[model samples]
Target chain A: MLEIRNLTASVGGNQVLNGINLSIQAGTVHAIMGPNGSGKSTLSNVLAGHPQYIVDGGEVLFDGVDLLAMPPEERARAGIFLCFQHPVEVPGVRMDHFMRAGYNAIHKSHDEEELDPIQFDRILKDKAKIVEIDPLLLKRNVNEGFSGGEKKRNEILQMAMLEPKLSILDEPDSGLDVDSLRIVAEGINQLRSPDKAVLLITHYQRILNYVVPDVVNVLINGRIVRSGGKELAAEIEANGYEGQGEALQPSA
Target chain B: MTTPDSLAQSEYKYGFVTDIEEETAPRGLTEDTIRWISAKKNEPEFMLEWRLRAFKHFMTLVENHQEPKWANVHYPPIDFENGVYYAAPKTNPASLEDVDAEILSTYEKLGIPLEEQKRLAGVAVDAVFDSVSVATTFKETLGKQGIIFGSFADAVQEHPDLVKKYLGSVVPYTDNFYAALNAAVFSDGSFCYIPKGVRCPLELSTYFRINAAESGQFERTLLIADEGSYVSYLEGCSAPMRDTNQLHAAVVELVAMENAEIKYSTIQNWYPGDENGVGGIFNFVTKRAKAAGNNSKISWTQVETGSAITWKYPSVLLQGDNSIGEFYSVALTRGYQQADTGTKMTHIGANSRSKIISKGISAGHGSNTYRGLVKIMPKAANARNFTQCDSLLIGDQCGAHTVPYVEVQNSSAHLEHEAFTSKVSEEQLFYCRQRGMSSEDANSLIINGFCKEVFQQLPFEFAVEATRLLEVSLEGSVG
Candidate 1:
């Protein structure tokens, strides 16, 4: 459902993603494990169409469409979701309104009838339960004064709301405690389907323990050097990223 | 996808002029010009003398070059002599039916229904068009409650004693350059007074419109809430688009008596200049309220999103024991607009309190500044004040500034002031965009969030209007 061909990207004039090739079919969860500064977050940002991350030379295809040619919003409308590493705090914008706007925008792009507040409220309440998010948190401002765990849960809740095809979870487990990690992983698992895909980007294999990935790839210096079954995550978890990139393919 | 930059370049929506025959005084601010305005309104002897006194004081300020350049705004020196001080529709309307169709349609176009049947329920309106009150609705209904509400001209004619007692009591003619100018040539504005112990039955509002080209709108509004009374007043204004800058200098005064409470809200959408800042209204207004008796309260809430240059500070003087003053403001400046606005709270009695919340949004080359002051007198023991000023900048080219001055003479006074300046970061914008909102929608959402506190203070209808106004004003401000 998604393909990346020589995806070279840079931010602030420094090349971050150097000559990367990856492909994911439907109903598969792919894990990209790397140490810090290994461009794990950069891959997610590039897919999400962040303005600062310039595409120096590359092309991304989502379901045969030129994904890189779209803006952030269009990419989102096209079912590309990137769970941010650090959720931005938007003070005074209520969680319900923010979620509802995004949900309705995507729905409208698909020529679906938009749900009114009352209708959406019921659906939101149900989604909140899937993630075990307290319904009251939806009344507060988005990510303002929220605990790290709550922010992660809120992102998962948004993912549940949008029901995107390609869900990129960027370190969703980084700041979570054991309990929150379970809830977030359970929520992601509940949303998994045969026709949807997940790109789980993380430095550790702990989250993989809960929502086991179908494939695990080790990323080093912006290049995915090794691809194997789920056992590769356990290997990285034990040995770390050291000597993981010795088989790096030369850049095109 | 539609680029927001081009969308923001849309023309000001309320820029259409009303083609009506007007009776205007000669262009200039001479003594005779003031006399001509006073005669045109058929003012009493003392009123004429008052105008002359204010005119003399204004002339002295002009001679001394005291046109208040202290504000963080830039504009060429105003040629006071080249502008018309008075411009009113030719036929004065004794009733809504007598008003010209053109003038009435103008109000309808501006979303203000002046006709009785079509008027907004639970709200009384006074429509002021270019130096004259064209229509005032629900007069009889308010009069039955002993609430006197009408035009300033009518107040002087029908309730001379009341008008004389409080016209310049709060903002005197000697207050400042703009106040003096407004006092001298002020043509028409709303006059409202709530009787003792009577809560005003309806929301009273004044809508000011500048329709005639080259005419300066100088309107003076005075509202009084007698002992134990309560009232909420709203003011809104707009102007037609013109290449030559027009002047709008207004003065508003409020007096709240013992146990009385007065709430004032303003949604100012005066015409801002073109994107390049060619010409617009130079809005220099003076608004002040006095909590004159014990336990009285006065609150000012404003959403200012118009005018090329705005220099106004609605203030409150807490004189009675345990009195209170509050100011909630949201000032949005886009394009070439500049606004230097905030408030002043003066604590004169023991246990007086004041709260100020200001939000300023600057986009394009706009500049917004929050300049406020909180002063506690030596005798005012245990006075308290809380002030918060937050500014949000949309683009890198715009600017936001906060200047607060606090003076506490009493040891028992407690004051807290918090300020923050935040840019609409790319991260936040991108996050919203990635969630399916367009860049423009994301920008508006973030700005509305930043201004939510102030918007909550507005009346429901006005809040909706203010939100839409902000969206229109900040269009094309973001990529």
Candidate 2:
């Protein structure tokens, strides 16, 4: 569903992602693990079309479309969802209204009829239960004054509402407690389908225990150095990246 | 002159005028003109005498004064001698039903239905065209509730005692140049009174439109809420497009007696000049409300999005013990418009309180300024005041400024003021766009969010209307 070829990105003239290549197919979960300053978050941001990150060279193809040529909103409408590690707190925009706007934009882009308030509300209430996000949170301003855990859960709730084709969870488990982690994992599991793909970016294996990935890629020095199966994640958790020196080898 | 094709493609929707018959006064200011206006309105002899006195004062003030240049405003010198001082609706209606159809259609075009069934519920309307009161609806119903709802002319005639006692008592003729001009040649506005111990049953609204070319609208509105009474008054203004800049100098005075409460709201959407600042209304107004007697309260809420050059300060005199005063405003300036607006709150009584919240949005080459003052007199012991002023700039070409003057004579007074000015950040916009909102939608959402604090202060219906007005006012630039 997604393809990246030699993606070299820079922000403020500082190269953040240098010649990184990756691919993901439908119905598969991929995990990208890296230490601090390893460009894990930058990869997610560049894929979401953040204007600050200038793609110096290379290509990103989503379902055979030129993803790099699209604007951020067009990318979102093309079913590319980025769950921010630090969710933005947008004051005065009610969560329900924000969700409806996101839903309508994607739905309209795909030639689907938009849902009215009544129909949308009924669907949102049921989805809120799976994410363990209180329905009352939808009435308040989007993520305003919410705790860190609540913000992460809110992002998951949005991900559920959008039902994007390629979902990038950027450290979604960083702020979640044990129970929230399980709930977020359960929500992702429920959203799994044959036509959807998931890319999980994380620093710990706690979340991987709940939503196991089919493949794990170790990112270092702005490149994907190694790719392996789920056992690679377990091995990295047991012995830190210090012992896995081969995984740090530069990829051609 | 710009081609019609060029001007026709302009996006200002309310820049057109309606054709109607008018009885216009000859251009120029003189004792004769004042007397002519008094006679035209069939004013009482005493009122005529007062107008003559004001006219004399106007002549003295104009002769001794040079045009004040300190207001941060630039406009061609107003040729007072070549401007019409008064114009009244020639069609007099014995009842609202007998009103002129063309004039009624003008209101209808503005989406304000004059018919009772289609009128805004529980809101009495006093419609003013140019310098005359065309019609006042719900008069009988308001009168049954012991409310005085009429034009300023009628108030001067039937309720001379009340008019004479309160007129200029709060804002004297010498308050400013425009105040003096308004006092000398003011033609018409609304006069509302809620009797002592009686709560007004409905919202009192007045709509002012400058429909005549070269005609200056100098309207004076006075609203009095008697002891223990409460009233809410709303004012709206608009003007037709004219190459020669038109002047609109209005004065509004409000009085809240002991235990009385008054809420005055204004939505000023007069014609702002073209993008290059060619033509529009030059609005210079002086509006003040005094809270007299103990436990009185007065509040001013305004949404100002129009006028080529707007200079107005809606103020409050908190003279009543434990009185409360508030000013909430959202001023938007697009194209070449310039607005210097805010409020002044004076605390003279013990335990008085005041709150001021001003939000300004500037786009294109527009300039938005917030000039406010809060004064606590020596006698106002333990008084409190809070002010928050925020400005949002849409484009780099625009400017936003804040100047607040605070004076606290009482050692026990507590006052806090905060001000911030910022442009919409690219990061914020990108965040919303990443959520599937277009740049225009993102900008509008951010602007609306920035103004939510002040917009929420308006009544529910007015809030909705104000939001829509903000959206419409920010159309071209936001996209």
Candidate 3:
């Protein structure tokens, strides 16, 4: 469902992603585990077409469309979603209003009829239940003063609403309690389908236990260093990132 | 949908000039000019004397005052002697039926329903044409309830005591250059009085339009809410597009007595100049409210979207113990428009509190400034004031500024101020875009979130109108 070749990007003149290559097919879970500052988040941002990250060299294709040339919104309309690690606090903006606008926008771009507030609210409430989100949180400002777990759950709720073809979960398990980790893992498991693909970006093997991965890739210094199966995550967890040959490279 | 080029060429919606027979005073400001206007309104001796006093002070200031260069705006020097002080429709009649057909149609074109049957439900409108108010709707019903609402000229003739007592009480003629000018040759505006313990049932509104060419519209509004009474008043202004700048200096005085509350809102959409800044209205207005008795409250909410150079500060004087004052403003300057607007809160009594929320958006080479003042006097023990000013710049060419002055004489006074300036972050825009929203919609969404506090203060209908107004003003502004 997604293809990346020679993906190189930079932020503020500093190259973050250095000619990385990856490909993911439908109905598969791919995990990219890396240490801190290993360009893990940069990959997610580059895929979403963040303005700050200048594409130095690369090509991306999503379901036969030129993903690299499209803006972030067009990419989203084409069924690409990224669950942010730290969702911005849009104070005074209600979660319901934001989500409804987003949902309507996605549908509108596809020439589909949009949902009214009442219609959208019912769907949102149902999706909230799937993600175990408090209905009250939907009434509050988006991500304002929310607990860490609530934020992660909110991202899951967005993913469920968007129903994207390819979902990039950027460190979705970070800062989550053990109980919240279970809830989050359950939400992701239920969202999986034959036509969908999920890319799990994390630094820990804790979530792999809940939503087992079909492929485990180790990324260090902006390049994929190792690729294996689900046991690879457990191996890295058991021996740490340094269990294999130098998991991190010294700065040039 | 608007492109950058199309936005620059977009026509002003309310720009058509009305051709009605006119009665105009000569283009000059002298003792005779003030006297002529007073006589035209058939004012009493005291009212005429008040005009003479203000005219003398204005002349003195005109000699030395340099138009208060502190404002973040620049315009050609105004020739006070070149503008006709008063211009009324040629045939002055006794009732709305006798008014000129062109005048009525003009109001219709402006989307302000002057006919009693067609007026917006729950709103009583007083339509001011040029220098005089030709039609005032729902006067009979308002009068039956002992609520005196009509033209300022009518108030001077009928409710002299109420007019004399409250006029200049909040905003005296000597307050500022524009206030003195408005006090001198001010022709006519809306007058509203809510009797004691009576809650005004309708929204008392005034719609001012400048249709006369080469004329200045200086209207004075005085609203007094008696003890235990409540009232909400709204004013809107617009002008025809012209190359020569028309001057509009208006004065509004609001008085809330013990246990009374007054809410004054304004959607000032005067004609901003063309994209090249050729001609528009120089809107310099003075609006002040006085909380005269204990437990009174006065709130001001304004949405300013137009005017080539807008210099106005709607202020409040908390003079009664425990009185409250609040100001909510959203000022947008686009297409060569410049706005320097905010509010002032003066705490004079114990335990008084005030809040100031201002949101400014600058687009299309527009220069917007939020200048505010908060003063707590020595006698105002335990006074509290909270102020927040947020500015959003649409394009790199536009400018946004905040100049806040805070004075706390008493150590017990608590003043909290928060100021934030942002360039409508690319990250926030990307976040919204990644949600499948258009760039323009994303910008509007983020701006609306930023201004949610101020929009909440407006009435339900006006809140929706204000949001749409912001969207229109922001069109094609982002790159």
Candidate 4:
């Protein structure tokens, strides 16, 4: 479970997230739909503890622990995963090597037995299949020269491997084709469980058709304006984010 | 007692000086110093004549003030007369057992155990302490295979013919100012020779340690692979922390005969001074390998992570038809360290080929430069060379430069060059950190990836040590 109480953040001296308040229960998928510059990505970055994003005001708690105080790596080890909109290219860093380092790091922080290369390979291969990622790509550098669809699928693969408690998919469907989008949606659907939560941040409602959300919240100007069922996604799709903030009351 | 802050501040882990009585030549570089070094080694008359000739030439260069001002590095004029030319542990060890415990412990502390039981498997080591080699492991085993592996001083006495024939054959003493200086006062280094048609059974290594303060270590390493022979040689250099700069002018020459192959790797970790860069070793080295006969091959793999100022170019002279030359280097300069290193591939024989891959990493106020040359003569038909230079900067104050010169007189020659410079982006760092790695680990991971190509060229154990060395060298380089 996670709780955000009037969380305000800024980036590069510009206030982006203006007192955002949201609460997500375990096992529920929450979709935050907003237009560009509405601070959807800012919220995701602030929650993941990105260094550039300063917490200007308010507080965020993950399992009753202060999330804003932890460093990015500590937040990651504590099971907060943010699938980047554009994954960075880490030249010469093999995907498997990077993943294994992350896997062992998180495991060690939790006092769990770490998996060696051989043991980890089996788990990686199985997870790769669930995400429909070509195993050959795992031998190459991380996100180096990866196509748009492949990058999204790679992020899903990492999500599957890390098994985070709260997964923030930031524009995962942004540069994907129909077939790639279907695969990403299916991967997310397969990763859903009663002990986990998914916060899907997107500007488009197309992905909502594939992995329907339990709660759909419209974010306008860094604040959640409307909260409704999955039908709210269809409503937004039919009538975009324009004038939605003025029409709907702020949700508690 | 060292705090974590001090440890990170001065990441030169091998900065400890061995406390032992030493026999040092009087401070200064003169004819008497050369004679003392030659007499101390008991070198043959021909060897002494060569040293005198070199010393005379070195004096001429000094008179002309030709201290190689072409390189893009800045330093105060060196005080040659104020530094000791030779400084060695007092006792001369006739065998491993006779080696002084303090000297042996110095090697052990450096992770290079001279004891038989703790010796690294398949790596015959010759531990050079200051001016003389104190211990040579697996000498008998190597000798049984008609492979002469021992100290250069011993080779001058035992295998004078081999030493005389190949010495200065690739990098002549007249080649440069430092080469002449090294040839004149070079105290001792490893000497190896593989007989015809023999592949050396194990790796040959030389570990040079500079413990005596205010002494310059002039090491001369010569390796010869006879016709149809093969050998892999590696050299490691380090020095203690000092307030005054020490000089390390070394010359390494390798000869690969017909159908022979020679592979040379170096892990140079001399002291890079404190964060303020007050004192350290000035490593001026000349390393060259010659493919003397048709179909021979020579490769140089180096990981240079230390030294206050490094100026060296490990080159390959492709004199034989169909010969191959390769240079893989990873030069990392942190703090105020400066490195100007690369390679030269000269194609004199038809169908000769060479490949160069260099990675330079600069952190703090460090400066790194890759200055390489690829030349193909008019008579050399169908020669080929491919070069790739990549530079990585960790902090804003650091700098990287790539200067590649290509001269092709033959129209049939084919050459290609690629160079790229990139900063350690904040996004890359955040990406790795978000994957659960600490900032240090993330920085190291990114650097290791950037250096993967060069590290893979090293031998297994050397590769592992080189990786760890890069990690240590990059300490405190980032927040």
Q: Which candidate number would show the highest DockQ if scored against the true structure? A: 1
Each model's iRMS: 0.4, 1.3, 0.9, 0.6
TM of each candidate vs. truth: 0.97, 0.94, 0.94, 0.97
Residue ranges of candidate 2 with Cα displaced over 4 Å: A108-122, A175-179, A242-251, B1-10
Model 4 chain B: which ten-residue window has the lowest total lDDT?
B1-10
Best by lDDT: 1
> Model 2's CAPRI class?
medium
Docking class of 4: high
Candidates ranked by lDDT, best first? 1, 4, 3, 2
lDDT of 1 by residue, B1-479 (tens): 34334435456899998988999998777889998999999999989999999999999998999999889999989988677999999998778789999998999999998887789998899999999999999999999999999999999999999988998999999999999999999999999999999999899999999999988999999999999999989989999998989999999999999999999999999999887898899999999999999999999999998899999999999999999999999998878899999999999999999999999988778899999999999989999999999998766778999999988899999999899999888898899999999988998899999999999988898889899988877766666
The runs of at least 3 residues in candidate 4 whose Cα sits more than 4 Å from the true structure, single-residue gaps closed, are A249-252, B1-8
DockQ versus reference, model 2: 0.61
Ranking by DockQ: 1, 4, 3, 2
Model 2, range B1-479, lDDT digits (tens) per residue?
12112222136666777887888997788888888888888888877777777777777766876445677677777777567899867887777898888888888777677887788887889999888888898999999988999899888888989998899989988777788778878888999889999988888899998898878899999999999999988888887777778889999999999999999999999988877788988999999999998999999999999899999899999999999999999999878889999899999999999999999998887889999999999999999999999998876777899999999899999999998987777777777877788876777788888888778877787888888888888876753
- How high is the CA lDDT of each candidate model? 0.92, 0.86, 0.89, 0.91
Per-residue accuracy of model 3 over B253-341 as CA lDDT, tens digit each: 99999999999999988888888989999999999999999999999999998889999999999999999999999898888899999
- For model 2, residues A45-161, the per-residue Cα lDDT tens digits are 899988788899999899999999998999999899998898776666788887887788778878899999889999999999988888998999877888888888888888888
Model 1 whole-model lDDT (C-alpha atoms): 0.92
The DockQ assigned to candidate 4 is 0.81
Across A137-180, the per-residue lDDT of candidate 4 in tens digits comes to 99999999899999999999999999999999999999899999
Clashing pairs in 3: none
